[model samples]
Target: MIELSREKLLLLYRQMLSIRLFEDRVYQLFLLGMVPSTLHQYQGQEAVAVGVCAVLNRDDFITSTHRPHGHAIAKGVPMKRIAAELFGKVTGCCRAKGGSMHIGDYSVGMLPAIAIVGSGIPIANGVALAFKLRKTKQVVVSFFGDGATNNGSFHEALNMGAIYNLPVIYVCENNFYGASTHISKVMKLENIADRASAYGIPGVVVDGMDVLEVYRVASEAVNRAREGEGPTLIECKTYRYSGHSRSDPANYRPKEEVEFWKSRDPIFQFKKKLLELDVLSEKEDNRIRSEVEKEIEEAINFAIESPLPSPEIALEDVYA
Candidate 1:
């Protein structure tokens, strides 16, 4: 077990809570038609993002999938800019162009998220290649869902990453369902990590709902990559509490499964652990919760007050 100081543990807790609350608020905003497009909220899968990112350096790169808000937040992109992007305001990370799916800030080492399934895999591989060629110690992480494992890009990227010993981490957030289809209907392998052997890379499975466990696994993978030992494939067994997208009701999943996952909600479990460790008191917990609530409220207000990109500017940033 990686022993973290109380402050570091609290930081992780805050991040997980922020993601949960942010998604919750975004859901409300989507319902009120405040968000310009359909959203793929990361409600229950907070631990995977928080854990992986918490171990990364500020210079490390991360490629995110369509469901990117939690990744963006955990990777240290300013929450206000993310909220602004969601609201289609000019002050967003992508200047209101990318919106929910593509929210990212390269200045913070985050790539503008790739909304296409499995596209980020090669992109992350390419980035890791660049880092290797440049002799930079920087590492890249590719975050994708279980559905992406089936994509050709996934296989090709992992193969190249392994052959070249690229400083990249392939993080598969296996949330049980690929959109609406269950993993059993698609994959024959009992574990996604089992596929790493074919590529000559180390593969490990971690509990996605437990932030500490995910962090422990990610720390080892990141260290290995930085040491030029090669890439590692980490499969996080998680679940998405909400629908695949705004249009999805997620009724395809059984109620019992959903409830079972909910009972293991990352924030609640981590918070309880913190209290047991005597690192967080009930009063401190309440204060932290209130502070996060205030931050989200302020972020929403900032987004609402920011101006939208002018109609004339739509043609301004177009590629030649």
Candidate 2:
């Protein structure tokens, strides 16, 4: 693994911690009916987004899945904007039109998340095509779940990307389930990355729970794409600590299974690693946590104070 500077390491820790705290706070607000619409919390898979986005430039793009809060934060979207979006405030990244599942900021190179499974795969390819046609060295990373790998869009998009050598990275955040269905129930293959061979592209599997490992693999893939080597299918073996949705109890999963994944929590593991490397101390870690908490609180206050969209202007941005 490539050595990371102390600054970068701390930034990664802060980003992951921010996502964890933000998601936890959102869940609390959701229970209190403060957040509107449905929610898909990104509680356990912070490493994948933070790790991958760390290797990207500000001009590079990323297409997020329904559970996109982590992606938005990792891509430099302000927490206040995301919180505002979740609260349906006018200051939201999408001006309140897109809520939790649709959070993104174009200025930060994140497309408003596509709620449809696997839909963003093709859209990312289209964006990558634009970059290629324009002869820009930009790349687009597409984030999806294991379930999306089964969708026809996934296959078609990968094939097209391979054929044209599009600068796109297909990251499969395999959390072991599609909603409530486990991956083993649908596919016999041991690893999702193995499917890359069918499209003549490189495929790699990484420990999604380990930020450093994810970063190492992502760096290679991003470099390959930037150098005109084409796309790669990276399968991140991760898990979600929360239920599929706001209303899901997630009881379908066995108790031991949940406990096992929780034991390897990405944020916890990363913090421990940093401490071991002497890159962080107990006091410093506490400071970071305290700062993150304050930031989350500020974001919540900003979203709460922000005004809702005017009803008269409802159709202002509607093109249809």
Candidate 3:
């Protein structure tokens, strides 16, 4: 087991809670028609984002997928900015241009999320190559789903990363479904990590529901990349509490399966462990919860009160 300081543990818990609350609030707002554009939430997979990002420096970069709120939050993007972007405000990180799927801040080292599956893999490699040529220790992480692994880009990118020994980490968040299709039906291999062998790089699989386990594995991979040991593919076996998008009811999943995964909720499990270790008291946990809730509420209010982007500037940032 990795021994984390109380402060680090608390930070982890707070980040995870923020993601849960943020996603929940976004869903509510979407239902009320307060939020524009569709949402791909990141509720059950908070641990995967927080754990991996916790080990990265501010200079290290991360490429996100459509479900990028958790990644942006974990990488230190201000909640208010993200909320404003979802509201399509001028104060948004992308100035209302990217919307939900493209939310990101280059200042924080997160690329505007790519809604295209498997596309971020090569982009991450390109960034890693620059880092290598510049002799910088900066690393890049590519976040993608199980479906992306089957894409030709995934294979081509991994092959290049392996041969060049670039400082990148390919993270596959396998939630057992590729936009509602079960993995069993599509994948012949039992584990996605096994695909790493074809590219000759280290591949690790971890329990994504356990934040500490993920942190431990991610820490090792990050350290390896920083030292120029080449790319590592870390497959996080996680789940999404919501459907593929705002419109998906996720009725295809069995009730028992959903309940089972919910029972092993990352935030709940981590809180329990913290309590057992005396790292957090019941009173402290309650205080943290209240504080996070208040923060999120304030962020929502900020987004609501912010002004929308003017139509005149719509063509300013466009590249034809």
Query: Which regions in candidate 2 have their CA more than 4 angstroms from the true location?
Result: none
TM-score of each: 0.98, 0.99, 0.98
lDDT tens string, model 3, 22-116? Answer: 89988899899999889999999999999999998999999999999999999999999999999999999999999999989999999999999
lDDT on C-alpha atoms for all candidate structures: 0.95, 0.95, 0.94
Residue 316's C-alpha lDDT in candidate 3? 90
lDDT score for residue 28 of model 1: 94
Q: Can you write out model 1's per-residue Cα lDDT over 1-320, one digit (the tens) per residue?
A: 57999899999999999999988998998899888889999999999999999999989999999999999999999999999999999999999889899988998889999999999999999999999999889999999999999999999999999999999999999998998999999999989999999999999999999999999999999999999999999999999998899999989999999999999999999999999999999999999999999999999999999999897777777886
Candidate 2's displacement at residue 53, Å, is 0.5
Runs of candidate 3 exceeding 4 Å displacement: none
Q: Candidate 1 vs candidate 3: which has greater lDDT?
A: 1
Q: What would the per-residue lDDT of candidate 2 be over residues 64-147, giving only the tens digit for each residue? A: 989999999999999999999999999999999889889889999999999999999999999999999998999999999999
